[model samples]
Target: MTDHLGSCLCGTVKFEVHGQFDSFYLCHCEWCQKDTGSAYAANLFSQSAKLAWIAGVDAVTSFTLPGTRHSKSFCKLCGSALPSIQVAGLLVVPAGCLDIEITMLPTAHIFTSSKAAWGQGLRDVPEFGGLPH
Candidate 1:
């Protein structure tokens, strides 16, 4: 198990997580794209219970996706997106937010049916129709 540290772009927010991640995932859902303003979002899957806010949790703002059960956090000052915890308490930490290099290859590409045609093709990773069980 490795301890990972991450912070928002503005350095106003930071967090740490420890233990083996369940997996890494590429989320291609519309909500992910809309929230991240990217073709997809790469995240590390881990238990939210192990996460610790090292600094500025108060500086993070959250917004729930309309008509959905998911939400995202971001730096209030710089609008830099933060990782999110889904309904089941699975923390999804953005790959870009990490201060260290993560060698964990993504385990799944989720929401394939909703993915953009020109977006990075799943190619080799396991593809899930939606959130995997």
Candidate 2:
């Protein structure tokens, strides 16, 4: 595993994570789409214990989307999305901020049923009908 660091667009928020990442992958869930204002979100998961916030917790914001217990963290200064840890304590970091290169391909794709039709053509990756739990 490798140790890495990253920050938001304005550098107001920064974090560090320890893990050997092969590469980050795209998440096509509708929540990802709406949260990122993009077609998909690039993210990678690591243990919560491996992540550390270096600065700007004061600018962090949290939101829960309607009925789902799943909540999200973001940068209030720039609206840049941040990673959230689940009850299992898995830290999911946005892949774009990684300072080190990932070596492993994404293990699988979750929420494939909600993927945009225009986002198709990823025929080789394993896909799940719903969230990959």
Candidate 3:
């Protein structure tokens, strides 16, 4: 029963997950790209893990994509992505929100058929420790 702590970017919400993740995924779905404003969303899924809100639970807000099961939760103040409880007892936690380091690698890249054209060959791009001058 490993425990992981997480917080929103503005420190408005804090939470903990007490159990191991079942899987990790990098989703390239269009809604994921639009909501994240990035090529994909890095998420961890757990079926048996328990989630606890340590603080500022009211600061969290969620949205579901109309008729789709796709849903996301974020901090109202900073708008940073947080954890969400999906259908069938699935807990989806954004990897970026975790305060502690995660040892698990992504289980797979999902929705690859919708991968962005600009998302390819990212490894070939120049790496910088910080923003390039």
Candidate 4:
């Protein structure tokens, strides 16, 4: 019954998802990496959660790969990733888009075979609380 609020980087799109996520994943597939412009996509999956747009629903745009199931929802203004429905039943929410705290961690790194060669050894890098000056 928990409600999660989310918005685009430009604040042009706002929404809420009502209910808990059933699974979380860090997808490292090439499509996910391309969609996120990162090494992986952190996504939460929910089959029963309902998405309600609070504002600017028209500002959202979605693209599904021409010959694949890969799809992405993003804000038209800032191109920030947003939530999208998949496989007709599951809702896929990008973890970074949520305004509320996420209690569930990623369950696994999926499609590791397609991960970037330079994506490994990230833990070996120095950690910082903020940008290192």
Candidate 5:
């Protein structure tokens, strides 16, 4: 099992996820897009893994979509996404919240029917390491 360290954007919340992720998904569901404010939400899923809060656990807050199983946890201060324990023994970790580099690639793209049109076919767009001049 591998251990990954992560923190909130304001560094108010810190945690470690211990064990291998069973799968990684890039979800284009409208809910995911709304929560992440992006074209898709990248998440790692695990059933056998565990979460340990290293600091500021009290700063973590979660919200579940009304009448749905969808839920998200984030830092109360910075509002950055954090790890969450979903129902049915599933653990979810946002891919971008980790402090260390991850080698695991996404297993699939889900809810593609809700995908945004403006986000498509961007592979041919210009690439830059930073803001363009």
Candidate 6:
């Protein structure tokens, strides 16, 4: 079983996830884009992984969209994305929250039909290690 540690942007909330991830998906659904405020959401899925809050558990808050299965957990202070459990024992972990290197790459890009128009051709953009001069 692989173990991973993660935290919010401000480090106010810390957690550990234990077990191997079976799938990783980059979701481009509208809800996912809005939840992440990005082009897509990188999420790791595990059916039997265990999540344990190591610190600032009270600083975390969760929200579920009424009348829908969409939900998100975040640090109340920094508004950073955290992990959440979905139905059928699925553990969803946002890849960005992980502090350690992840050996696995996204298995697929789902919800392509709902992808933002601007989300395409991102590879054409310039790449830089840091702030460009």
lDDT for each candidate structure: 0.83, 0.75, 0.96, 0.93, 0.96, 0.94
Model 4 RMSD vs true structure: 0.9
**Higher-ranked by TM-score: 5 or 6:** 5
lDDT of 6 by residue, 56-122 (tens): 9999999999999999999999999999998887899999999999999889999999989998989
Q: What digit string (tens of lDDT, one per residue) describes model 2 on residues 44-65? A: 8765337778899788788998
Tell me model 3's lDDT, rounded to 2 decimals.
Answer: 0.96
Candidate 4 runs further than 4 Å off = none
Per-prediction backbone clash count: 0, 6, 0, 0, 0, 0
Candidate 1 ranges with C-alpha deviation above 4 Å: 120-133
Q: Please report how far candidate 3 places residue 81 from its true position, in Å.
A: 0.4
Clashing pairs in 3: none
TM-score of 6: 0.96
Clash pairs, candidate 5, are none
- Flag regions of model 3 displaced more than 4 Å: none
After superposition, candidate 2 runs with Cα above 4 Å error: 20-25, 121-133
Residue pairs clashing, model 6 = none
lDDT of 5 at 44: 95
Which tens-of-lDDT digit does each residue in 41-111 have in candidate 4? 99999999999999989999999999988989999999999999988878999999999899997888899
Model 6 whole-model lDDT (C-alpha atoms): 0.94
Tens-place lDDT digits, model 5, residues 1-133: 7999999999999999999999999999999999999999999999999999999999999999999999999999999999999998899999999999989999999999999998899999999999999
Deviation in Å, model 6, residue 104 alpha carbon: 0.3
Scanning candidate 2 in windows of ten residues, the lowest lDDT window is: 18-27
Regions of model 5 farther than 4 Å from truth: none
**Model 1 global lDDT (CA atoms, 0 to 1):** 0.83
For candidate 4, give the lDDT of residue 8: 93
